[model samples]
Target: MRERYEFEGKRFLVLGLAKSGYAAADLLHSLGADVVVNDSSPETGSKEVTALREKGITVICGGHPENILDKGFDTIVKNPGIPYHNPVLKQAVQKGIPIWTEVELSYLISEAPIIAITGSNGKTTTTTLLYHILNIGGKQPLIAGNIGTVACTVAQNAKPDEVIVMEVSSFQLAGTESFRPKIAVWTNLYDAHLDYHGTSEEYALAKAKVTDNQTEEDFFIYNADQHEMLPYIERSAAMKIPFSLQGKKAEGISADDEMIYWQGEPFVKRSIIKLLGQHNLENILAATASAILMDCDKETIENVLSSFTGVRHRMQFVKELKGRTFYNDSKATNTLATKSALSSFQSPVVLIAGGLDRGHSFEELRPYMGRVKAVLALGETAERLVDFAATCGVPLAVKVRSMEEAVQEAYGVSVEGDQILLSPACASWDQYPNFEERGDAFIEAVIKL
Candidate 1:
């Protein structure tokens, strides 16, 4: 077991007693710290609270006392879901209380090196790939962060010998203060979560914070091709390990068809990469580059990548329905990701798009109208997308009420070798509970067809 630090009678309060919070509470208690666990929803976090309380941890569910912070807790570790605008966090700031997210807390207790990854889309896939590559290369890696397990929880359970591979999201990035990783891999960035952050600039800044805390000793890994990240790349204090799929080969790595190569080092990786699209290849390049930076040998990196397949809800090839391949890419929740998915195929695509509008411009997607045979729009953003595609001179553009109607129509129109892709370029909250639900529905409907 990992050694819990001796808090020396310091008071530690854990807000949002979810899985991460329970782990935080236990670790704090083991260190002889006075720990208080608070969860606003007992029903949501009920079982977790009971388990923690069974271990002698103080857990208060249902509501947080207004004067709780007045007790002078030395630190408050907040769950990532709690926004920056939360009253608890606001009060903590006002009272000058040291508040940390689980990620921030992980950075404190972590002895092993951390490889942190963040981006608008491919971070989850990249993180999982890197974890596999590192382990195959003889480095034990603990996979955690936004993809599954929480960071501090992983840290408390982690053996000191492993490398921590974290799939960090922009929301998690926003709440962290000093969560510095040894290797910060920024896959890419784009306008997302404008609803919470209020602006694209704020969202970018929050995503950039994954590297904001890095020191001169740390290394910053970035995609040089992303124009969004290029303008802000110079701001990083860490030594840059840049990777690019386009342009000149840099100090890090680059990949052409035959090889995944560094500046001068060449490795003809046996890559029968199953994942489609240039974006996925870029994801592979980024993950492979990260592996090399972490001291993974070229052979191990290549081997792990060759054997690996894509993740669920991203771009899983569902099945062939009426001669058309149905691809469930319900994870493409924004225009950039959807654009990548759409551009992946040279075939005539019947694109099932539209979802909640995040105030992004659909003007750039007009160029893709020719490649897409028909645009079957659905979700709340359907009408707006239909209007935009019409302006682009697409005669086959049509709007439908739901995913089922859209899928059936798309299947009807698609010929042999054509593809039906569910890559919604907008948020999923408009119709479904989330993107996963939307993607699942797409798969279910297509399978029946």
Candidate 2:
């Protein structure tokens, strides 16, 4: 209801007419900023675009005209899907226009505290889990960001006492200015989204911004297990909190002998998380650490973990037919994450993989190939993967196209005690809308069989 920016009278260019961009345009206008919103869509009949014109914000739907980015504007803010390296974004950067993401803009205006979570993987599970624990502990936390919700909308409408639990992505992180979370959590980092961020280091730099502007009073919770993040962690002067899943000597929170602990603070009750897989255990540790640091009641933390159902696409069980289990791990968009999903199963697996090739190495997928019954490759990357897995002793590999064929072939080749895992260690844009669609298709195919 309130305007955060005084830009109500200044010129602003809003790019990417998606949810965040539209919200950003409206928020700027509420502050008296003159804004023009653009979407690449070639049609002007969209309901949200129509609403923007009605609200008195300038709406230029049907495609982004190049002249728009060239014109003088006070600042530029982008939606999460708009790559930081886009030509328009690059031009804006060259013009020295102050660029910002929706998260950054929201942070600038919010009166409430924030706990922003960012990572190549694990952000959604960690963000949602943290929110669940906070609610159980009696805190009002609004969940938003790359986890399929507009945080700017939530932050704009929430009361001052309520906090924001944000799942920020690398795209959102790149253009951030003066955005800092009270408790910033970086779960882990791997080489992902090279198509957008260009290099793994650049991508990590964007993600590290979760703690970028943090002060010593703010908490920077990171994975002690990811050595790549250690350079940033060591240099961070913020109140450092680290979590681990293996060995002792880890500081902030850890799990030992089927028990979870936060900073040596024993939980009031012994808790056994119901989620399957060791990767889920890692998510459990991160959530427990952040909630405890937020001063959530020990009992609330324990209770929430018990009730926390895992995220939809990450290792979601479809069915057990003919004595073989089917798991939809469409969220495993990288080798490391897929490896984690595969490592959870002790039985032999007919692992269905391959998708939009992201320059990922199958070397990491090698160690776990022994447990995989055979490799079922799909999409553009299939042929190259067959050879890679064979190096790890998987002599039998089947190449198929589409999730249906992969599932059918897997079922034909697998028998009792073997698992059918759709854990493709690659992006889904080649054949699906997102990981969700890919995972959904995998489930649908399994149900048909």
Candidate 3:
């Protein structure tokens, strides 16, 4: 790990004690910074807190003390999920104290060039795919950020010869200042996390930060199909590499129904790709473009694309039991994502959906319900989704109380050639802690069947 002397003697405040917060605090403390970690959760006796305290860092828990900011800290390394509207953070802004997410720290200490991926959806899939391609192509890539591992933790031990592939979120990007990636990929943009960002424009701006500090020497691979991303593309200093599913463009990556082309040259046959959905094609194009920029050969990219079934919980093919294939798309926590998942299959689909109702209408989903043979709804939005499914002329709509019940109901409605997909068009918080847990439950239930 490269030694960073800049943090030495600095007084740093880490807000919120999640994975990112812990990693940032530990790294900062190790670099000679006087770190004070604060978590709104009341669990002061937690092992994470105890460990930080053991490292000579102050641990504040239970709540945000109003006077904590009065301590005159030089900078604040915030957990991405912690809103800027938090009382402590609002005060920090008023005081002109600079704040950063752990990713900024990752960039500061890392000897390797970073490849950051961000989007409203498909960040994980693209990050994972690019990492796979790079790894197979002998690029020695280290995966981190929102894909699971903390970015700072990965960067801590990253070597100069290696590359860091990070799946960054808007929450993380919003807190970054100089966290430029050598190659950045914006999979696609959509209305998401408005509660955290407060506005769509703000959310887009946050995602744009992936390329904010990138130079002409760097590469920005983005969705040319998303017109909303054009403004940000124009503002970026990086060399633009556009990927489109529409058709073969003048340059960059483009795909037809049969082939994926690189700068108008046929790179790979689309029929060989195991990943489902046209949305995934966009992800493929973005990742392929990134791998090319990383010097990965066409053969390596094709090999990875052909073998990668899908990212787990994101339109992942679970199994084909008695010829009724099941897919777990628990990551489809919004209408746009669910629509994409629904469009992936040609066979009749027994879709198990519904979760936390954020007051968004299911009307946006109506147009895509044609192939849906049956609907097994669950969680807070169950009845609402069933009612909506009825309006869409879906033959069978059942309200299921649990994931197991939903899976069983889906199987009951599905035939041998049909697909049973768990692509909840709402957040999992109403029934489970997060999407992963909800997806795991669905998978376990599927295995039982």
Candidate 4:
């Protein structure tokens, strides 16, 4: 839509055909580039694959061919989930072919200035919040990236007057080269995706790429509480803005128990904010800072914050039956997130947790388990989490086989005024495809009850 001619006539390889891959291949082909799409998944006859082939783009499926790179492509638009250690990607590296995620493509073609949010957690909440704030403030904003909608697909129709609020993941950032956002936010850093990155440092660096191509004209809003992020902040050429839960002294955007401050000035009172958890306060501060930079009015920000409960699968309230409230937080795929969810409630909790093991100890959750009345664990890490719950001295700890079982058991253990929460501190990959499906299962089970 922005009349990008750089991709024209260039030979491109679009790897791993999911949503991002399909969008990338389609965009590249439309731009008059010679595009070949490859996917390891055996969805060869799928609608997307069929469509691409009909458009005269080569669509290869089932597995990566050893000689696939023989065609001498100018660039590879790779799907984020595919690791660099992948044989075809490793070969691309050896041959010095440029590899990019679809975000890079999105950045190149979009007429709209992008506001990107990335971190180990809170990306979805922060992205959604900022989008809401900007929308309510009369700014035309589009939501895209890792939050679900393909960014390139959004970019194709993005108007120059619009703004793109993107949720970027470490995997997507890792494959980026020239993908700079006009406003970049690093919510907070934690050890995550170690298997994909091989080390915490690599993961952090990948997250840092949101600011990599930025210049002094851009804005980098980061978590001041994360000392590990300081070095990266100092190195960025973008104008630095910080947000913290640690009061007004943070000097950018800070929050106390009473109020949210903007550069040491009172902006909004804490009581008016509706989102749950201290971690969400961090998200609020970050989103508020970005909105202020975008010239969104304080009243608009306050209105959005006061009413925005949360994004789905992330501390979303379901239903209250017989005075026992249910919340679906299947997005809490790590201990830190679960800790935040646990801290949000004062009532005794019947927590339904556990999923893919990921070989990490749930010991980090022990200190926050004081309010957990019972633990209904499920999936690959069910037994281990229940054992850990026992060690935490939780009164009722049981391993359940499925979400339905977990929901039933949680209700059985809960009493009047108790909170039944589905905040799995592990990934849903063991039993569900993703956190969303896991959350949907929990919600359906709760509805059934």
Against the correct fold, how does model 3 do in TM-score?
0.99
Off by more than 4 A, model 2: 1-5, 265-271
lDDT score of residue 192 within candidate 3 = 89
Model 2, residue 216: displacement in angstroms?
2.3
Q: Which stretches of model 3 miss by more than 4 angstroms?
A: none
**Which has the higher TM-score value, candidate number 1 or candidate number 2?**
2
Clash statistics: count for each candidate: 0, 6, 0, 0
| Candidate lDDT (C-alpha), each | 0.81, 0.82, 0.92, 0.93
Evaluate model 3: give its lDDT. 0.92
lDDT of 3 by residue, 129-235 (tens): 98899999999999999999999999999999999999999999999888889999999989889989999999999999999999999999999988988998999
Candidate 2: clashing pairs of residues: 7-32, 7-33, 8-31, 8-32, 8-33, 9-32
Model 2's lDDT to the true fold?
Answer: 0.82
Q: Which clashing pairs does model 1 show? A: none
Cα shift from native, residue 300, model 2 (Å): 2.5
Model 1 Cα lDDT, one tens digit per residue, 144-226: 88887878777766676788998888777776787888899898877667777788888888888888888899988888888
lDDT score, candidate 4, position 43: 76
Which 10 consecutive positions of candidate 1 have the poorest summed lDDT? 264-273
